[model samples]
Target chain A: GDKVKQSPSALSLQEGTNSALRCNFSIAATTVQWFLQNPRGSLMNLFYLVPGTKENGRLKSAFDSKESYSTLHIRDAQLEDSGTYFCAAEAPGGSAKLIFGEGTKLTVSS
Target chain B: EAAVTQSPRNKVTVTGGNVTLSCRQTNSHNYMYWYRQDTGHGLRLIHYSYGAGNLQIGDVPDGYKATRTTQEDFFLLLELASPSQTSLYFCASSDRDTQYFGPGTRLLVL
Candidate 1:
């Protein structure tokens, strides 16, 4: 069984549209983080949360530790947003190491 | 700004060869981790270190070895490489709740 699972392994969105990504954790996660891996293979951190919500520009993320789930919402998709999105979770009893999901490939077209 | 860099961005080797991937972090973080990413399978932890000279086995450690020579450098070694070991390798460093990733190393075993 996977500790963290991401939904919609792949997604396509038209520019200016809105979309959301979800991550479900089988372990008792204490914290969660979201990242976007660009085509060049560099991963950029999007959000780090602890059972709460955070918003930056057009992206919003929420983590529910009790439910062991997290969500990333994107608004006004742009071409630059086309990349692979990954969600990682940190279990309660473990060191700050993370368990990552397979990732969702997102493509935004005009 | 925190930065983690991986050397030999792309590598190609024949079966049963030896390969080494290097990672360096300028963030002065205490925890470093090595992970591999494969399509349809999320990132799997290969090894990690809490500090210099401290190595710990991760979820997938068979056929792989890791060394933390210094506080800022961590290296992953693949001995007797096989095609199954061909994947994108990423190095990460964490300070508290946020984990920063380096540009991945793409390895191909023929």
Candidate 2:
């Protein structure tokens, strides 16, 4: 079985639009992290959460450990937001390992 | 800014050949990790180290060996490469829950 699963494998949004990406965890995740892999193939860390919500600029993320899920919301999407978004979860205990989802490929066009 | 760098950004090897991927982080973080990303499996952890000379196996550690010679350097070794081992490898350093990633190394085994 898949430990972490992401929905809406691919998405397309118009400039200034908004969309959301979701991740479901089958493992007992203690924390979650979000990242964006840009077109140039560089991974940029977005957020690291421990069961709550955090907003930065036009991006907001929420993680619910009890419910075992996480969501990343993009507001006022721009051309620079076009990339693959990935969510990773760290299981309970002292493990630093992160189980990742396949990712959501996003395209924001003008 | 926390900088994590991986050397030999791209590599090509034949079956039974040897390969090594190197990573260095300047943030002085205590944790470092190695992961492989495939189309369907996303990013699967291969190995991690909490500090110098400490190695911990992840979910997909078979056929891969890692060494952390210092607080800043971590290396992943493939003694006998195979076609199935071809993928994009990432190195990351962490400060608690937040992890910063490297540019990644693309390996191809023929």
Fraction of true inter-chain Cα contacts (below 8 Å) kept per model? 0.84, 0.86
Error of 2 at A37 (Å): 0.6
Task: Report, for candidate 2, the interface RMSD.
Answer: 0.8
Q: Cα lDDT for residue B74, model 1? A: 98
lDDT, candidate 2, B1-110, per-residue tens = 79999999999999999999999999999999999988888888999999999999988999999999999999999999999999999999997778999999999999
Tell me the DockQ of each model, to 2 decimals.
Answer: 0.79, 0.86
Model 2 quality (TM-score): 0.98
Tens-digit per-residue lDDT, B1-110, candidate 1 = 67999999999999999999999999899899999988877788999999999998888899999999999999999989999999999999987668889989999999
Candidate 1 lDDT, A1-110, residue by residue in tens:
47899988999999999999999999999999999999887888999998999999999999988888999999999999999999999877767778889899999999
**iRMSD of all candidate structures:** 1.1, 0.8
Candidate 2, A1-110: lDDT as tens digits: 47999988999999999999999999999999999999898888999999999999999999998899999999999999999999999987868788899999999999
RMSD of each: 1.2, 0.9
How high is the lDDT of residue A53 in model 1? 97
Best by DockQ: 2
Please list the residue runs of candidate 1 whose C-alpha ends up more than 4 Å from where it truly belongs after superposition: none
